[model samples]
Structure formats: C-alpha cells, structure tokens
Target: ENEVVASMSANVFKVQVAVGDKVIAGQSLIVLEAMKMEIPIESPRDAEVAEILTQKGATVSTGDVLVRLK
Candidate 1:
C-alpha cells in the first residue's frame, strides 16, 4: 500500500484520479495551488488509487494524506 501526502500548505486545485483508477509512476494525481503556482502531486509508483482524502477547492497542509494507493 502507498499513501500520497501533501508536501506543503495549499489549496487543492484538482483531483486527477478517482478511486480504483490505475496510475503509473510519476503520474500527476492531484494539483495544488500555492503562492500563485500550480504544483502537481504525483504518484510515486504504479498503483491503483484506493481512496481520495481531499477534493478540489479544499485546503490542505503539509503531510496531510491526499490519496491512498494499493
């Protein structure tokens, strides 16, 4: 199992994957907006998205789990 966590405080700009979606390593799973920049949160390995813990327009902090993968 793998977990994707936010790397910094930001607003969720978009969620690119849904639960049960298959993803590849380095695939963009979410987009975060902070400091006027768009930051892409990517998958670290090939896996199936098991859960999404956040949504677009939601605020998140560093280390917050955004998605769970298996």
Candidate 2:
C-alpha cells in the first residue's frame, strides 16, 4: 500500500484532512505553527487518508507523523 506521511519542524496547529478523505498531490493535510507563523503540510501522493496521528493544537517535532494515507 502507498501512504502519505506528514511531519514538520514545529508545532502542529491543526489537521485539515480526515480519514477516508481523498487527497491529491500537494493538497494541504495539516498546519504547523512556529514562531507565530503558520506552516502547511501537504500530501505527497494521490491517495485516501488512512489515519490522523496529530490533534489540533498539538505540539509536534520534526519527526512527528501528522497524517497517513492508504
């Protein structure tokens, strides 16, 4: 199976994609906030969202997995 995993170099602010949602390449999946600036995480492939590993306003690191696709 193919998957789209997302992570950031800062705190994650929100997850925009849900499970079972169809996503395209370069589509936004999560938003990360760092130093008061918002960063958006995008999908790498055209697939369906399989899991959400981060919550809204959750503190995350560079290696954190924000979303998974299948």
In terms of lDDT, which candidate is strongest? 1
- Let me know the TM-score candidate 1 reaches against the reference structure: 0.97
Which residue pairs does candidate 1 place in steric collision? none
Q: For residues 1-70, what per-residue lDDT tens digits would candidate 2 score against the true structure? A: 3543444567778878889999998899998888899888888889999888888867877766778788
Error of 1 at 17 (Å): 0.4
How accurate locally, in lDDT, is each candidate?
A: 0.97, 0.79
**Candidate 1 lDDT by residue in tens digits, 1-70:** 3999999999999999999999999999999999999999999999999999999999999999999999
Best candidate according to TM-score = 1
Point out where model 2 deviates above 4 Å: 1-7
Would you list the clashing residue pairs of candidate 2?
none
lDDT of 1 at 68: 98
